[model samples]
Target: MENVTGLVEGEETTAGEAEFYDRLRPLVASYCRTPRIERVAVIGNEPLGSSEERAAMVDSADLVFRVNGFRVDELGSERAVGRRAEVVVFNRGVRPTPWFFAGYPERLYLMIEPGRLLWENPKLPEFWPQDLGIVTMPNREVVLPLGKALGADPRAGGQWATTGTVMLWIATRLFPDAHIDAAGFSFVDAPGQTSWNHAYGDPSAVGVEHRIDLESVLVRRWIDSGRIAYHR
Candidate 1:
């Protein structure tokens, strides 16, 4: 609705973004655990928001947190921009591109896309057992407390030490009756960087391909194992 001018190219044009948003809307409704998303966070080099973006979010997302460092002026404007959103965009990129921000929860779903982030970072496995990989990572890194000192992307792997694990992790502090669903190469068990690249299209769309069957595997394990908290 509001004319989105001056957006970075490649997923930045108004028509382009509108199409992306159009694709994203029903996709979430179709794929997510619920018609409404409870709450969500997406941390990346860039930030995208629209009034309908709020409506597009599955019904559960009462609040949406966007964490990005690149756009300072635009950051503050997010609140005003997405009038329909109970949204907040944090300006965390004062420094160079490092890892994901740690000011949120302890454990989360770090969206490691295979496009932008991986492209900029030729170095793979900067950190070990990274929050999640752009796609498949060496099986060795998938340990508990999720290892930190490994060979994954330093930015991604550093999260385990800083707060938890990931170049970026998006999770809910107040989780509810929810289920987990993620997509992409890792979700389907496709291996290698090439497969990851082909399957996921773009690395910046971390939150996109992430699917979950975690209600049984991850959530049940985390809560029942006394590993994580499940609250209202």
Candidate 2:
């Protein structure tokens, strides 16, 4: 565990880095004690047909996990996409907007891609959430090797797993006893289309690189084995 200052990208360390890590360490320890739950929902931002039954099913889960740039507002939201998130995962490349923290007020954990965030956010540790229960890192050392082993493309210099894929993996590891459910994730685009990017931006809008086909293959395997209950 390197210090947060060294882990995040920036020429100079910000004042908040030390204090934030100081508070973060103890909180992370406590978060590990979270009681086992029967179900955990991992939400993606893919398009879905709105259904009250689906929404109620997601809402009924004991814990919910959402990835970057998801909507929790009432207006124009589907019932299947619940309003609450117990844990939120973020990509390092995307800076945490005000809405990111706002949507997870009761956050039990704030999972982040530290190395990527450091490279992407040149400002380093500025404008971060201080009140979250715990800050967890999905380190590249863990992500890259595991993703490669799971058929992720190695051509991108080992950075290929999307946030949804990472979230799925995390849910399995963290809540082994819980039934993992996922929604809003369809790895392929429409017929005769290129890769289907997430709901947050236009296709190829960001510099982040990933192999959607490989991720889709892996996800499909997980679905087949009943590891992930994907909302079709």
* Residue lDDT tens for model 1, 89-120: 22211222222333222222223323332233
The list of candidate 1 runs beyond 4 A from truth reads: 1-37, 41-60, 70-232
Ten residues in sequence with the least summed lDDT for candidate 2: 1-10
Clashes of each: 34, 3
> How do the predictions measure up, each by TM-score?
0.24, 0.69
Model 2 ranges with Cα > 4 A deviation: 1-35, 73-78, 95-99, 103-105, 114-127, 130-134, 138-141, 153-156, 188-208
Q: Choose the strongest candidate by lDDT.
A: 2
lDDT of 2: 0.58
- Compute the lDDT for candidate 1: 0.27
